[model samples]
Target: MTLLPDPAEARAARLACRQGAPRPTAGMAPGFTQCNMISLPKDWAWDFLLYAQRNPKPCPVLDVTDPGSHRTALAPKADLRTDIPLYRIWRDGVLAEETPDATAAWAEHPDLVTFLIGCSFTFETPLQQAGIEVRHIAQGCNVPMFLTDRDCRPAGRLHGKMVVSMRPIPAGRVAEAAMISGRTPAVHGAPVHIGAPEALGIADLSRPDFGDPVQIRPGEVPVFWACGVTPQAALMASKPPFAITHAPGYMFITDVPDTHWQV
Candidate 1:
């Protein structure tokens, strides 16, 4: 059985990550939801929100903060500026650098607004409970993510290709995996594609655009899910002046349980 930590303990682990400890959050806090955070200047909030609205599967929103505020309803006591394990700093749509925490970045852009996009990792717990083998977890690596050829509906200045994360499942259990994850729309509910990376214009399963790749065994097929990283791809395409996002696979732990978003 997988060990699941309570929310507070999970937050503490994040705090350690903030202080320079490195860890991927894929299988942590098993019953709690995880989020992908995007922090940007208030000037860019509305367009991004509209973008998220236009593409709900990959960009399902968990929470949004008021202008210049770091606090969110997702985890009242957790500091948005410091809780996520890693953050990607983007300048003019280019990756400027990666840091474990966002304190300095927040200081440079104090007027930033934060959006917490739901993550598919939040649903993996149930998949595991149902006896599905989460391949990346079993392989002990970050879930592999790819950028697709698909275009999202344009919303102001935010528009880009959809991004997806892949996991290998036994051929026979693919439907069961889909059904288990389908219940939580808030966290990217179900598999978008299965068995064909080329169908999505993804050329190679081993060379993912983000996160680490895992092996696909003889009886397993690669399954893809819409990813919150889709917004980061949008950020890259739109060339936002300044932005911050949780590095892929390193998510923000929320106070709410994963089951709260079940449909």
Candidate 2:
């Protein structure tokens, strides 16, 4: 197994990425569980929380910030307003800007509530330990995500079809991949569906809704799992007056370990 990078080191690396430091090798921090962040006004908190609950496969709830508070308690003494390497601010369902920090924008909205969603990083450690290679990490490209035909149960004003991330696994190791990831429910536990992409309403594997596509080797099967991007899609569909989320691939590393999420 590769030695786990120090959390402080990982945090500094992310900070450097944010500050335009030369891009470090991708996937250097092997074991730490990374998270997807969402910040919204207090009025929408209850609805978004319920949305995540209704769609556990995609929106795995981890931690949340106190209304109007910038600090996140679940992670390593981090600030929700700035710890993330990059942020996306949405206005009326449209992306307004992608920036390194949201402190300035968030300052204007004193009643914002932040949510940290579980990410696939929590499960990738075990996958790699089992000798399954994560292609995107090896290729230094963002994990490919797609919008699926699967619809999540509606909650208040939050409702939308599920979005998923794809990983190609060798035919011999598909079951092992599924079993290893199925154990951790907090970070989108298990594959929601596998094998065919078209079965999930994905028309073309090469053109993903988000992120770059990886070459699926001839014998490898494309596997699909629920993705954290579901919330961003929901937020877009709902068209909330305002919202914020972590840029894809840039997640918030919490203080908790993968074992902390084990069933």
Candidate 3:
């Protein structure tokens, strides 16, 4: 396996993404922190911040940029507008456009406040180091994400159902995987559910609201983690006039090391 990525690699990954390499970033910059991004209007910042605070499990915040700023403290030199592999523009609760670059959108909305939220990918390395197979990475695909029946605590104009990223873990190792991940509370600590898609309002494992599906081999049980993508779902349900988010599975790689969040 490749050694843990260094800061240079992290920067290079972001640069590659900025330059238009449209690909999923699951195992990219392994061992470095990766984040989910949401850039909202400054007027709605307080409301969203409260929403995130109210639902920390799915919206754990890492760094929030100042209004109109294109940078985050998570990566001093990284451009939030273009460093992510792909971006989704939401207008009035509808997906407007999917782009590799969001510079134009950022310029149009100068009051945008960017939020860098924690991601489950941070715990992937630890899971791998412990001899577990993260099915999505092993299969070279994006993690499958689904919307649950549970509604999140609403704040201001933000409201939506919880979204979860699923990984099929060996039934015997489900507890071990949860404990390993539980150590990183800042990055979506642990599995919210295990082995029962129906319980989460998911009717099929093959179809996901976001991201691609991975195989669930024999004796492997499905495990779900609170996803930062939940914010996008809230945008749809709450009908925010304008918003920007990292396209599911295409994350913003940060300068922080994964170990920084590990307990």
Candidate 4:
């Protein structure tokens, strides 16, 4: 049996997994649910929220922060402004800077609204428990994500192609993997497509739009799922005045349980 790490350790492990460098934690609180975060000005909040609701597969809504409030009531005791290890600050849809803290950024624009999206990490534990191997974890690299030809149902001022993360599953176990992951719809649900990368317009499996690609050993078929990165793609295409997202893999741990997210 795979022993799950304690929440505190998991959070630390996640922090260590950040792109580079270690930062100080103001208060080390354990056992919280770490979510994927996005912050945008009040003007863009409505469109983004509607976009998330419309495209539930790629953008699963966990919680939305009140305008100008840095505290996340959904993950009470969790500070939306500073709990995450890293953040990407976007300017007119382009990634302008990355910082370890969003407190200063938030201070700059007090009218910003924050969003907490469900992340696949919530389902990973159960997937592993079911004997499915997550390639990125094994390779110690970020999961390979692709910008697919698939377009999300657009909301006002928000429109872009879907982004997906891929993992290779042994041919025989693909069905089981799908069933296990399908149970958690809030965090991306089941496989969007299975086998044959070309169907999704992915030309070379070795090259990915984001993150490092992993090996697909013989007998393993590639599996793809809608990813949280989809919204970032939308942000780019929409060219919002300002937006912020958790840097890839740097999620915000919340107090909720994975099982609670079952559809």
Candidate 5:
């Protein structure tokens, strides 16, 4: 497997992302934690924080930045406004534009507070170490994500259905996959569902609400994990006047080590 050490790998990835050529960060810094970032106005920060706390599985809080600031404790040298590969601008909960950086958004709305939420990619390294194949990475595409029938608890104006990322695991190794990922609650943690896509209101595995679809081969069972994308869906539901989020699969690379998330 490819190995890029923490911090250095993260810094290089951030530099590449800042170059205006945005792409998925999955498999980039293998052992570093890739984070889901959302910047909201201070007026909406408290409710969003509550939403995360109440829906910890999908919105695990990794680190939060001070209001009007782009720096986070997760990576002192990183600029949250531009380090992510892609940024989504949401106006009244509707995605307005997708860009490589949030500099313009930050400049326009200085009161935005940033939230660095945990991502499942943090645990993918250990899964790879355990000999599990991450098919999307192997296929050179973004992980498959879907909106589910499950609902996340609402915090004030924020409420929406849960979203999940799917990984096709060999039946024989499903237990091992669960064990490996279950240890990292700071990330999305374990699988929320293991077999049926239809049960989650996902009609087809090949079609996803966010990210690219990956082939689920024969003899493999589809595993679903509560995804950070849930918040974006919630933002869409709640219709916040303004917000900024990392595009699906395009996450913020942090100095935090993957091991730091292991419980």
Candidate 6:
């Protein structure tokens, strides 16, 4: 089993990530909030904001930074360019490169505006405490994520299918898992679907569009949650000229306590 990150070590964990740790953030910084990041050019900000507002389930907006600024009210001391474990540089909707540090991209586009979307990882600790097994964390790897046929409401230039993260829960605990996660609507809220991968148009669970696949034990049902990475799916479909996002499964850890968002 993967060792859970210290709740009190949010700053320390971010510092480690800044120093080039390549591990996924799942199960890391357990009590601190983790979020999906997407930085788009200044001109694209309003459209993206509208998109997130229209699709709150998969794109709950946590904190948005000012144009050309690297700071977020979510974490004052953390640097967005370097604190995330990994980043994807997108050009004209194509994935240009994955990098550990993104200072160059920020330096190049001073008008890049960053948005922090709530991550399902924020609710995992509560699920575990409620005795639900989070398969990906138990497997010591990144959570599995998939793109579904379900469409998100479009806002201006943004439009795409929804993306989801899956966790295999025992059939008996599926409802419990949903309830535990639903307490914090800001962080994905609840399972969007339980069992039946094909229902979402996901052909197979073993192969995921992003992140690693986790095992689905016989009695366990695959539960899906609205994923913040849906923005990347939009980037792929809409083909924005320039954008930067956290690599799937890698997240930006914020100093905010997870409980702060819990009901």
| Model 3 misplaced stretches (Cα beyond 4 Å) | 1-4
User: For candidate 5, lDDT tens digit of each residue in 144-214?
Assistant: 99999999999998899999999999999999999899999989998999998899999999989999999
Residue 119 displacement (Å), model 4: 1.4
Q: Quote each prediction's TM-score.
A: 0.96, 0.93, 0.97, 0.89, 0.97, 0.96
Please list the Cα RMSD from the true structure of every candidate, rounded to 1 decimal place. 1.8, 2.0, 1.3, 3.8, 1.5, 2.5
For residues 110-173, what per-residue lDDT tens digits would candidate 3 score against the true structure?
Answer: 8999999999999999999999999889999999999999899999888999999999999899
Worst 10 residues of 3 by lDDT: 1-10
Which of the predicted structures, 1 or 4, would earn the higher TM-score when compared with the native?
A: 1
Off by over 4 Å in 6: 1-8
Error of 4 at 233 (Å): 0.2
Ranking by lDDT: 3, 6, 5, 1, 2, 4
Question: Model 3 compared with the native: what TM-score?
Answer: 0.97
Write candidate 2's Cα lDDT for 1-263 as tens digits.
33544667556645654465333223645566678888999999999999998889999888888888877666555677676767889998889998877888898799999889999877887888788999988888888889999889999998888989899999999999998999998899889888888899999999999878988998899999899989989988899999999877777766566767788
- For candidate 4, write residues 134-253 as lDDT tens digits: 787777677788999999999999999998888899999999888888998988889899998898988998998977889999999999988888889998899998888887666776
lDDT for predicted candidate 3 compared with the true structure? 0.93
Model 1 segments beyond 4 Å from truth?
A: 1-5
Comparing candidate 2 with candidate 4, which one achieves the higher lDDT? 2
lDDT for predicted candidate 2 compared with the true structure = 0.83
Model 4 bad stretches (over 4 Å): 1-34
lDDT of candidate model 6 versus the reference: 0.93
Clashes of each: 0, 0, 0, 8, 0, 0
Report lDDT (Cα) of residue 5, candidate 4.
38
lDDT of each: 0.90, 0.83, 0.93, 0.78, 0.91, 0.93
